[model samples]
Target: MRFKLSTVVLPSVLLLGSACIVEAPGGTSPEQRRAATVTQIPPLSVRNGANLGRKVELVAATVQPGRLTPGERATVTVYFKVLEALEEDYLIFVHVEDVGGRMERMNVDHKPAGGLLPTSQWKPGETVKDEFSIYIPSNESPKALNIWLGLWDPRTDSRLALTNPDQVRNDGRNRILLAQVPVAQ
Candidate 1:
C-alpha cells in the first residue's frame, strides 16, 4: 500500500491551518489578552453601585494611585453582585478615556474572570472582585482620564441597560462611569 504525496501533504496542511484558527470569546485571538486574577469574597456594602439591568449590580469600583501621569501604571478593581442568574455570558468592557469623554484611549475588554467564570456562571448573592491593570501612554496630554465599564453581548452588539440612569452617569452607550483619575500636569 503506497500513500500518494498529495494526499498525505494536503491533509497535514489542512490540519495545521485549522489548529491555528482557534478564536476566543468576542472573536479575539488568545494572544490579545493579559492574564487576569479574580477572587470571590463575602458580600459587603457598596461604596458606589449601579444596576445593570435587573440581574447584576456593579457594587464598587476603585482605582489605585488615585492620580495618574504619563507613562504610569494604574490598577482598577471592580466589584459586582449577582442580583439574578443570567442565561447568556456577557463580556465586560473597561475603557480609559480622555477627560472630556470625547475619545477613548484604550479598552480592556474580556470575559468575566478572564473567561474562567462568565456571567452565566455567576450565582445570585455572589460577590465578584475583579482586578486588572493598564498603562497610561506617554503621548497623552496632561488631562484627567475617565474609566468607564459595562456589560455587553458581543454577538448581538448590544449592551446591558444601566437601570439607574438618574444615579449613574453613562456615555449614552450604556457604559457606566467607573472613575476619574486626575493626571499630573
Candidate 2:
C-alpha cells in the first residue's frame, strides 16, 4: 500500500505541534482570555463549592472509601473552578490531620496536574480536576481524620483566602476543611 507523502508528513507535523506548550498569540493576559466569550462553562460533577480569594472556587472534593484505616491508601480528588484571572500558579496541598487539627498525619501536596497545568493558565469558568493519593501512617492513632486543602504560593508560603469563611470550617492558617472521615478501628 502506498501512503501519500502529504498524508504521512501532515500527521507527523500535527502531532509534533500539539506537543508544544505555547502562550496565547499576542501575549493575551488572563483577563483578555476571559473576555473572549466562551460558549459555556463545563458542569461540575461534584457540588461542594467554596470560593477562594474570589479568583478560584473549590467546586468539590471527594475521598474514596469515606473511611480510613492505618496503613491504607485513599484517593483524594479536588475540583477547582476558575472564577477570575490569576497571574501566578499556586501549589495545592492536601493534608490529613487528626480530628482536632492538632497533628498532621499525612500531607499530599503538589502542583496541579503534576505541574502540567498551572493556575495562571486557567481561564475563567474553567474547572480543573486534580487527584492525589494519601497513605495513612500505620502508627497513626485510630481517630477521625480531617481532610483539608488549599492553594498556596510556594515562594511566599501565602495561601489563598477562603472567601466564604463562614460556610465551612477553616483553620486560621487558611486551610479549608473539606471532610471528616472516621478511622476504622
Candidate 3:
C-alpha cells in the first residue's frame, strides 16, 4: 500500500510544530523575570510612606502601571523624609485595605532604607525610598484599593501612634494614606 504524503506526514508535522519550544523573550521565564524584578524593597522593613508624625514624614507614594488586576503584581514606591531624629530603630508596615479602611492585606517590613539602615540611623532631610510588589488575591480583589503606611514594633506587637490623628484611619493606628489603586481590567 502506498502512503500518501498528506495523510502520513501532515499530522506529524503539525504535532512537531505545536510541540516546538520557544524560549522566553530574554531566555528567562515569567517567574524568573518576576524574581529579578523583585519588590524594590524587602518586605521585612517598612516605615510610614507618608508624614504621619514628627519622627518621619512620608513625602510621596508612586505606583507603577497604576492599573491593578487580580493575580497581577504592581510596584509601589514610597518616599519619606526624616523629620525628627529617631531614638531607636523601628519596623515599617504597609496596609492594603478596602475603601473603608478594612485591611485586605498587610506587609510589615524593616525600614524602606533596608535592614542596615534603621529609623534611628535616619537623618533629618534624608530621603527614604521604599518599593514593593503586591499580588492581589482573586478572592479578596476589589474595584479599588487603598494603601496606608506606618511603623510598628514586633517585640511589643504595637503600632507606633501617629502624631496627626487626622491621618489615622478606622483603627487610628496612624496608617498614612499612600494612594488609591484603581483596578482596571
Candidate 4:
C-alpha cells in the first residue's frame, strides 16, 4: 500500500473550498429579512434625577425628523424646568450613539451665550430650552440609534469639570433621558 500527497491534499482542498460557498439567507420572507437585519438600540439607564443641585430639572426632550436620512443632520431639543435660581455653573451633556458604536457629546448652556450656569442662578420655576444639531456621516449604516442626556456641575470658569476619576461610571447616573432614532436610506 502507498499514499500520495497530491491525492490526499487535492481532495481535502476541494472539499473545504466547496464548503465555504454559502447561499444567501432566504430573502423571500420580508419578516424574516427584517428580523435578521433589525438591531435594538441599548436603553439609556439613569439613576439620579436631572436636578443634581436643587433647581434644574430636565422636563422633556424631542428630536426633529425622529427618523433621519442616512447622511443628513438633525436637531434635538431639550426642555428643562428650574425649581430655584441656579447660581453655580452647570452643564447639560447630550450624548449620541450610532449603529456603528460611535458616540458624540454636545453641551448646552442655561443661557444662550452666558455658557454653563450655576444652579443658584437659574430662577425658580423657569422653563429653558436647549437645542443641538448633529450631523450623521454619509458612511454610517442604517440602524437603531441611542441618545442620552446628562447634567454636570461646571467649574468657576464655566468649564465642565470632567476630571473625576470615576467619570465613566457617571454614565449610569447622569443619563437623565434616552431616545432611539432611526436611520434609513
Pairs with steric clashes in candidate 1:
none
Candidate 4 local distance difference test against the native: 0.42
Scored by lDDT, model 1 comes in at 0.61
Alpha carbon lDDT of each predicted model = 0.61, 0.61, 0.51, 0.42
Give per-residue CA lDDT, model 4, range 1-185, as digits (tens).
Answer: 12111111000000000001112332124442332221222132122124544445555555565466656666555555666665554555555565366544333323221223233444565555555565566665546554555555546433322223132223434453345555665
Candidate topping TM-score: 1
For model 2 the TM-score comes to: 0.71
Flag regions of model 4 displaced more than 4 Å: 1-50, 99-120, 156-171
Q: Is candidate 2 or candidate 3 better by TM-score?
A: 2
The superposed Cα distance between candidate 3 and the true structure at residue 85, in angstroms, equals 1.5
User: Candidate 1 residues 1-185, lDDT tens each?
Assistant: 11111111000000000001222455323333222223443243225567998888887665555556677676666778888998887888777777675445677776675454667767787776666676666666546666678998999998999887666666666787665556766
Give the range of the ten consecutive residues with the poorest summed lDDT in model 3.
9-18
- Model 3 RMSD vs true structure: 20.4
Number of clashes recorded per candidate: 0, 0, 13, 14
Model 2, residue 51: distance off in Å is 1.0
